[model samples]
Target: MEKNELGMTHKKKEFSEWYPELLIRSEFIDYSLVSGAIVFRPSAYFAWEIIKDYVDKEFKKIGIENVYFPLFIPESLLLKEAEHFEGFSPEVAWVTHAGKSELSERLAVRPTSETIMYYSYAKWIRSWRDLPLRYNQWNNVVRWEFKNPTPFIRTREFLWNEGHSVFASEQEARAERDQILGIYLKALRELTCLYGIVGKKTDYEKFAGAVESYSIELVMPDGWCVQGPDFHYDGQNFSKAFDIKFINKESKEEYAYQNTYAISTRVLGVMVATHSDDKGLVLPPKLAQKQVVIVPIPARSEDIDKKLQDYSEKVLNTLKEHGLRAFIDNRDNYTPGYKFNEWELKGVPFRLEIGKKELESNTVVIAIRDTSEKKGVSLDKLIEAIDNEIEAMHNRLYENSKRMVQSFIHNIESYDELKKNIANGGIYHAPWCGSTDCEIKIKQETGAKITNIPLDQSDLHGRCIYCNKEARYMANFARSY
Candidate 1:
């Protein structure tokens, strides 16, 4: 079947099926020959570039430098951090032999960079002057999972930036963790048009061996709550494990405080699931490679052909002049409706249609993808209209999803309520006494685990929804992806 013929007829009707289909049709990713891996096509690659460029700049603003680490870890090194190794052992892919010759020690393909990256950090730090060593690496990690891989969301191999840093004191490390998360919050808003909940994960859900882990969670259209980007604070746990220490001003040695964070291609999955609709992807202007698509409507009258082409080029040039990612579809074989469908499925933010009627009226008709609104735009005000409409659409997407994030959250006041509503999907906010047993009970019975405790809810409390004990904090719960 031709690409346009498929036309995304089932998107809103069946989103789970729609998302993967849109991803494949839109040329974002495809299943690879290797199990649990995907080939990132241009659409996915370019979007990652925009994200990488933005966050790289933001990281530099806070003194985080970029670095690269080896992709293989020695067996001895991987065993250094006991808790981390134990947590990751099942998923680690070990290289037992070097093709023809068997190696003396096994090397595990990097599941996460902590073991290898920190091995280097131990060598570089000597004194208090080298206290805070902030570095970030853009690379791929392999977690060989047994579950069914879903492209960007759950692939065995995926691209991500793992940021690692060291600090002199626990206070300094904790502050850096939050500072890094703040940078992520800004980037997420500008890049994805996402508004997410800020919180710290429960002890059971926190990062392996980290003192505390924090997250910015987003609710998708399918009612799943996923952690987007996050920061982790390691209070000497790793430094002690890896023996990373520095001399203090008093000439005594103390373990260095450390942290690590990640923002992966998984965000792409969340963005598509959050903002997209029936037609296809609804990319924010900032994330799109080509934000404006100009389709020259075919002229029925023979004399008006040149006028349509000429005016279309003029409008396209003006958009480019204003620094927009704009392209004009001057294909001779396709109809205007076909061009519209093509760009709509690709999620171009705005479509400018120029036809004989629009030329005669000295105006252009634009289709806003976010709202599916079409309006006639005056020729004199074309530039301003395009800029305004693009911004308006981003704002509209943000506001709509922002409301959905709040509205979908079900506040449960009792255990029965948790059991009844959890399977239906949505963020469940419930009061909880700080107890792992209660959390386990909820998960075993209802299949919802502790996602996070919002920073705002730390002080607010009541009776535990399950045990009726004094509540420690209100927490967010959901069946994660």
Candidate 2:
């Protein structure tokens, strides 16, 4: 086979070159006519649809209703929240012209729906009876980021579920954080088969206009940290700005407390980068569109070829009946060897081979994707065997990701140690005194910034790694994506 035809030309260690090749060559996604945007292929979109469906079902169970907002936000509405507008100003794309004429008011493309969504929230929320309004929108947003885009990872436009919830009290709003974060964690574990660190963002790193922000952070193969799903507590900052006031239970008017959270398509990129290999993409069973592919070996005789085809069909049917996504690749143009390589590159979790021997024995040779272990399974017990293999593969992928992240973490006691090792890649667990100056100075001296102060603050004891002051929290610092 030619080098390009075989799969990725660059190995996983050559990440910068290899990642795009893996994504494009594997037919996962393609570059769009617009710069910094991508067109999701069938497999990539299928994975995202699975993720969306799972999250949407979870949200619906918790009383979060789905709704859609206008894609354009007027500049006046965006400027209602000064801090929020300022924070997003640089990247906010605007629509100032309609045909040949310039519009009277500039409309900012939806960098986020907070400004536009809350406008209606202010109007709709008028009485205590409308105390808690939980709404979520699964939509796309444009940020027009200047940095080089890496498909879903750093795209100028991306899809996500923006969850905006309003409550009559701060206590009620605050309580939603854990429930929502728990849902994201479960989705990452069950759907993506990935692990992440959940933590609180520092004041300097918190969302603009939010009282506090919390995120699920994942470490990339290159040792860079990427912010995953995040929840923000907008403690009446947006409510006051947009006049989202409601009558209290005590018969008094009060500003509504709010929260916003999201899980974007970016996690798909993270999953692809973390689990895939030099040969091609390595997808978890749940994320894979076709979990099993049955490729029948040609016998070069009409009678034997017919038998092999029949056996391959039988195997495919058995897997499908048990709720597995299975397909038969009996293309006459491609050799069995080519079919195996194609399916392997596409990251099908299991590949079943049916040949003369297997046909005679009423069995099929099953090949595992992550591990190249092949075993023969009788057709009668095929479903049971596949179920077990899927479970094992899922667990294996999650554990591998967890171990890789754990291995990259370095607990540093001094600033010098951090500077010397920050470039090598990995999360630096260090003590911080909770000062923005110390955070800034550390970031300036070393390119690493605080990823998050972990929710687990049980072992914080040492002095600040930079200022040498009494420690406030144990923060994970890393150069991020």
Top-lDDT candidate index: 2
Clashing pairs in 1: none
**Which digits, one per residue and each the tens of the lDDT, describe model 2 over residues 298-375?**
889999999888778777777778889999997898888888888888899999988889988898889999998999
Task: Report how far residue 215 has shifted in candidate 2, in Å.
Answer: 0.2
TM-score against native, each model? 0.96, 0.99
Candidate 1: segments with Cα more than 4 A from true spot: 1-4
Locate the minimum summed-lDDT window of 10 residues in model 2.
1-10
- Model 2 residue 78 CA deviation (Å) reads 0.4
lDDT of every model, 2 decimals: 0.85, 0.92
